[model samples]
Target: MSTTSNPYRGFRYPAEIINQAVWLYHYFSLSLREVELILAARGIVVSYETIREWSLRFGRTYANSLKRRRPRPGDKWFLDEVFVRIRGKLHYLWRAVDQQGNVLDVLVQSRRNKTAAKRFFRKLLKGLYYVPRVIVTDKLGSYRAAKREILPGIEHRQSRYLNNRCEVSHQPTRRRECHMRRFKSVRQAQQFLATHTRIHNHFQLRRHRLTASEHRAARDHAFVAWRDATGTALIG
Candidate 1:
């Protein structure tokens, strides 16, 4: 339990309700209305609009708190970019993940050129304490150009198959995109995906690699971490 000041101070709802609402929205592909109905089923009468407001206000706060508690990321980084149509306009979604499939960062840009690649590289390095040992990407020449200037000493592997980890990681974004009926703006897409990746990845234990009991333990640990991140663990 923590002695820190309450994050839920002044809110109409208690920390537990807010925490559960935020968790449900991010941990699954559920909409705000879906979360509202779920809460209503439990006798909690909250509107979907309020749920949306809570998500917009508190999602990133919780995500950043969780990021501070994660262990150092893996040294092998996989970078990839995919085109997303926002409001019928094209935008690039840049993503980086470590070897273990943990998302490092995500950037939404208008181009996949060298400048965009360089910017994404800088964003990744700015958050990390150490440079990666290696970076894998598809045959994107911008990555090669960016790496030469930004990560001169690290190994860069360009292959269509070597970076499947990052490519597969895009599936969740795609699913969410479809669920949301497509993103309305670049900023909205970036903000939602940035927070979504952190919170979703926090609970994404690779159950296939763990025994049944181990999976349960990992899930319990994830819940505890979520509690700590959202300041709900401090609640008596």
Candidate 2:
């Protein structure tokens, strides 16, 4: 059996329930208790704590599976950073996304200096098969400094208006942070957001840009991909 088939081997609850619970929590701004209540309304009596455990254990696994299945990221990369307050300590969330709005990666760090920027660049390029043709960012000197050392040959565009795509991408993270009453720690924030972005972006069809039938087709394709990632066999 494939390794994907083994993740829920010892779990008592069915894989469907676990998959649905994790999906509801991460794909939406729902809390663990909210997910518990949603499942309870469907006659499943799982506790919020159990749901939390499920998320921590299996969320990254599912996300990785989906990432492996996604198409190659766009060559035009847009990078941005936003401050996140965890327990009154300010940290920066460095995020990279493609021109198509696909999240490339995210890193949470204590600083936004050149060192932090270089670290984020390295993380972003770690698994990428090809380097980006152009990197766009706001007028941040760190990006300029880091790009010189890390991505020396790539084009770097610095403009506030041109980077709105990356800036807008941060809105979802902000919403999720508020919904969770802010993350408890740096590690927690990093782990959760890493999984959250992948899963969230997977299902985020550009409906406005797609026709209704095209939208439905994209959504159905997304569901099929989700089932494959979760190792949930289709029901006849």
Candidate 3:
């Protein structure tokens, strides 16, 4: 097992509170002040600014630790891109997920042209260090042009309906964008979304496909894994 050392050095609050604060912010489409309100309701008084600091500090660490424990991604990858507003300008958020709905990677770029598509494709493949058997994407000409240059050997399927898995995956990000009133900058959107995807993936159990007992067991397992990943036991 790959162990992650605690990154919460010299922190006044316990690791549990810190982890929970980060979790509530990333795992849900809640704002910093909203998280503060929620924690206050539970009798744990903490400022929203502090919560933001904790998120910026420990969010990436926790996400990286969780990624280390994730299973190898499925062979069929679904790729998609959506426009996000940053500082009143448009940027493209490129994302990929496997057949099992496991997020492979995300990238924010200024354009959605052939060059942008190629860059995002390379980044996703390089980060994973593995090639997919097939890639499903919308009928974006840039995708075809980019795929030919990047991984021509891989099968590419183009159909808007066939790529529903990736389309559905963007809903959470859309919700988060609304909650934050749109991202302030491209870098900020990339950082927050990257961390958010990992944490969301960790807890997304597809409960609809599970029996009640199985759902409970799966949820408990996810929490245990989260505790291990954050190196903090959540206390009631």
Candidate 4:
């Protein structure tokens, strides 16, 4: 396991408390105030604003740590984009997931045109390193146009229901949107969703495929990974 330098150097609280507060915020669909309430219930007197700062400060850093520890993405990639409302303006959230539902990358953009598609493709390529054996997407003309320009050789499959895996992946974002009363800005949506996806992917072990004992073991393993990723175990 690779070690991450501690990022909690000057924080007044211990690493465990700071990591727990951030975990509660992103690991679940709870608002900052809601997280504050839960911590208050536990006799911890952290304010909502402080929790917000901690999430903003540590969320993406921790998410990147977790992503680094993840296995290589599947050879077959599923790509999709969904519309999100940011302060009443429409924006696109482009996401890619592997066959087993591991999130590869996410981008928020103002358009879903060919240019937007190409931009997302570039981001995915720069991050994932390896080229996919095949790409699956819905019947979006922009996808075909982008693929033709950027990844001409890879197989591109498109159908109405062919990319159900990517479609189903949007459910968690929808739930989070409703909980937060919609995102305040595009950057906020992008940042939160990026962190949210990684945290979700870590614990979403597809329980139906596992026995009860296996599921419990998987959850425990994920918790240990979370601790390592968040620097809680390392510091405390």
Highest lDDT: which candidate?
1
Cα-lDDT of candidate 3: 0.90
- lDDT of residue 197 for candidate 2: 93
> lDDT tens string, model 3, 82-131?
99989999899999999989898899999999999999988987778899
List model 2 lDDT by residue over 1-236, tens digit each: 13534667788998899999999999999989999999999999999999999999989988988999999999999999999999999999999999999999999999999999999999988967678999999999999999999999999999989998988999989999999999999999999999999999999998999999999999999999999888886431
- For all candidates in order, the CA lDDT equals 0.93, 0.92, 0.90, 0.90
Off by over 4 Å in 3: 1-5, 233-236
Q: Tell me the TM-score of each prediction against the true structure.
A: 0.98, 0.97, 0.95, 0.96
lDDT of 4 at 236: 43
- Candidate 4 lDDT by residue in tens digits, 151-231: 999999998898999999999899999999999998899899998888877889999999999999999999998888877
Clash totals for all models, in order? 0, 0, 0, 0
Give the Cα RMSD of candidate 1. 1.3
Candidate 2 global CA lDDT score: 0.92
